[model samples]
Target: MPAGEVQTDSIVRDALNCGKQVFIPYIYGASKKGTTNTNIKSMMEMVKLNSLADYESLQRDRWGIPAIDPNTFDQREHVLQTSLEKGEGLDIIFVPGVAFQIDPNSKLVKRLGHGKGYYDSFLHRYQTKFHSTGQQTSQLKVPPLYGLSLKEQYLSTDDEMEVPLETHDYLLQGLAIGDGTFHNSTS
Candidate 1:
C-alpha cells in the first residue's frame, strides 16, 4: 500500500492485516470456441492469492495493472467454475473505471471502462442479477460490487446525460471515489 492514492491501498493493507485472504484478478487471454465461431475470443480469469509474497510475485500486464503471473499462481478454471457454482467466492469486487454515469433517481450507475473490457466482461458474469445481456442488473444481492474512480471520473448527475451502453457492459451496485467517499445504490 502506498500513500496519496485512491485509498484502496489502505483497504488492501487492512484486509491483509486482519488475516483476510486477498485475491487479485489474474488475467489470461483465454481462447474460446463456439458452434459457428470464426475467431478465437479472449477473456479474463479471477485467481485467488494469499500471503505478502504472493502479492510481490505479480508482474504488471500491458495495461499496467499488477496481475498474478500464471507461472506462479494459476487458478483460472477452478476459480471460474467454483464461483459460478458456489457463493463463497470474492466477498467484494473493486472495479476501476474510466468514467461514471450515475442516476440516483433510477438507482443505477453506468461505467465506461478503459477499453479492454476486462472488468466489463468479468462483472457481467460475477455480479448477482447482472448478466452480459443487459437484463435486470440492479438487485444488489451478490457480493458488493464497488467501482473505484477518481473524482474527475464522476460525471455530472444533474444533466441526465446518456451514458452509452453496449450489451457487454455491467452495472455497478456501489461506488468508491478517490476522495474516500463510498456511495451505494438506493432502491
Candidate 2:
C-alpha cells in the first residue's frame, strides 16, 4: 500500500479504537469517486470495529445507535440539518485535500481541496446557523480535519495554492500526514 494510505489507515484505526467517533465527508452527486464507507468498514473490521457511516449517521447515532441509509440525504446541508434535528453535534470532521497551509497567527489551517467548495460551503452554512442561535459551533473549536494524500500527491509551500475560504469559513484544527504524523496548529 502507498505511504499516505498507510498513514490514513493508522490514524483511522487509532481514532476508532480510542472510541473517538469520526465524521468523514462523502461526496455527493455525479462527481463522486473513490472508496465508500463499505470499504472503510472492511478496513475497520481488520481492527475489530463493526461498521462505518457517513457524517450524517455518525452524528445521529451516538452510542452505536444505527442510522438509516445515509444516501437518502441530498447533500451535506441535509446531513447537518438532520444532525441538528437529532440533537447531536459534530465531534470530528475528516476532510480530504490535495494540500493545506497553517496560518501563523491564529494557528488556523485551510485545505486546498478538489477546487470545488462543497466542504467550504457546508462549513460556512452551518457556522451561520450557529452564530444566529448564539450556539458554540464545532468549526471554531479546531477539530482535527485530517487531509488524506498519497506521497506523490504532496505539495510544498511554493506551489502557489489557492485554498477556498469564505469570509466566515472556519479553519482546520490539525493535519494528518500520510506518514501517520499529526501536525497541530500553533498560533
Candidate 3:
C-alpha cells in the first residue's frame, strides 16, 4: 500500500484469524440490469474473501491495493446476495478516504473520497436493495460506517476547517485513526 493510504493487510488478517467473514470491494462497469455500462464506467460491490490465503493471492491494482480478478467475479459470493438471502448485512464497514472531518455543528463524520463515488454508490445501493424489501429496519440492519485513516488525513479541528460535502454523501458513524485512537460522532 502507498504511504498516502492506510495499510489494511493486518485488518484482513485479524478478521480472518477471528473466523469473521471478510469482504473486499470489487469495482466494475455495470448498470442495475447487470449489463456493461461503459458510459458511467463505475460500479462497486463487496465480494467475499474466503481466507487470508485468498487475499494474499490477489493482484494489486495501479494504486497498489489488492483487487479481485475479473474472471472470478461470477464465482464469488457478493455481500448483497448474502444480505438478501440470509437477512444479515455487514456489522461494520471500515471505509477508506482521501480525507475526513467532523462537522462541528452536527457532530457527524464526513469523508472525502478519491472522486470515484464508488463507496457512496455501493452503500446507497445496499440500503435501497436490502431495506426496501418490506422488512422492518430492525430486522434488516444497515451497518455502521467507520472510516479508517491516518492521522494526517483528518482535517484540523483546532483550526475549525470545514469539509465540503454534498447531499448524496453518506456521513460516517465513527473513525478509526491509525494512531490507535477512535472517534465516534454523536450524530
Candidate 4:
C-alpha cells in the first residue's frame, strides 16, 4: 500500500472487488540462513476488502510486503491444503522473480530470485506432497507458476542470468507473463 509502482495496480483490490479470495504470502523463518518459508495458502490469510480502505488498512512488515491478520480469516478452511482435495488443486501461483529464463521447448519460467531460495523450496515440497496423494487419482492440478516483470528484465532464449539451481530447485516454466497466459506447465 505504500507505493504501487513496483506492482503497478492493486491486484488484490481487483480480485476482492470481484468477490475472489486474495491470499498474500505469510513469510516466516530466516532468509539469511537460506531457509525462508512462505505458506502462501495455509499460513496466508484471505482478506475481505469491503472497500479501498480495507485494502489500505492491511499492515506491512519490515520487508514492506502487505500482511493479513490470521484472526480475521475463517479457521475452518485451508485453501492451500484443500487445493488437492475435492478433485481440485492449486490452479495458479504468481511466482515473483527478479528475472526469468524460459525453457525453449517447455516454455516454463525458471525464476532468478533475489539470491534466496524460498519460493523454490516451497514449490518443490508442495508439488511433491500434492503428487504423493493426488497423482494416482488424476484429480490434482499442480498450480501453474507464473511471473511478471518489466520488459527490461525479460530474458531472451540466449541470455543467461547465471542463477544457480539446486536439485530441490523447482523449474517452473509456465508463466502468465505480463498479459499472456498459457497452459503447458502443469495439469
lDDT of each: 0.63, 0.49, 0.83, 0.55
Winning candidate number (lDDT): 3
Residues 72-170, model 3: lDDT tens digits: 987888987765567667878888998889877677788999888899988998888776765446755778899998988888567566677998999
For model 3, the stretches where C-alpha displacement exceeds 4 angstroms are 31-39, 135-139
Better of 2 and 4 by lDDT: 4
Model 2 clash pairs are: none
| Model 3 lowest lDDT segment of ten | 131-140
Task: Tell me the tens digit of each residue's lDDT in model 4 across 97-131.
Answer: 67666666666666676545667656766667677
Clashing pairs in 1: none
Off by over 4 Å in 4: 1-9, 30-55, 70-88, 135-139, 160-163, 176-187
Worst 10 residues of 4 by lDDT: 39-48
Off by over 4 Å in 2: 1-22, 26-71, 74-79, 104-107, 137-144, 151-170
Collision pairs in model 3: none
Compared with the true structure, the alpha-carbon lDDT of candidate 1 equals: 0.63
lDDT of model 2 at position 170: 53
Clashing pairs in 4: 83-89, 108-173, 109-173
> Please, what are the lDDT tens digits per residue for candidate 1 over residues 1-187?
1221244546766787788767666555454312243342566656666766666566765655567666664433344555445534556788766788776566667888767887776666565423322332343245666788788778767765566778887777888777767778854
lDDT of 2 by residue, 1-187 (tens): 2322323445655776677654444434432323353522211100112334332234433423323334543443343455544444555666656666666566666666655656666666555654555446544432345555554454445566645565645577776666555667652
Number of clashing pairs per prediction, in order = 0, 0, 0, 3
| CA RMSD of all predictions | 5.3, 10.1, 2.2, 6.0
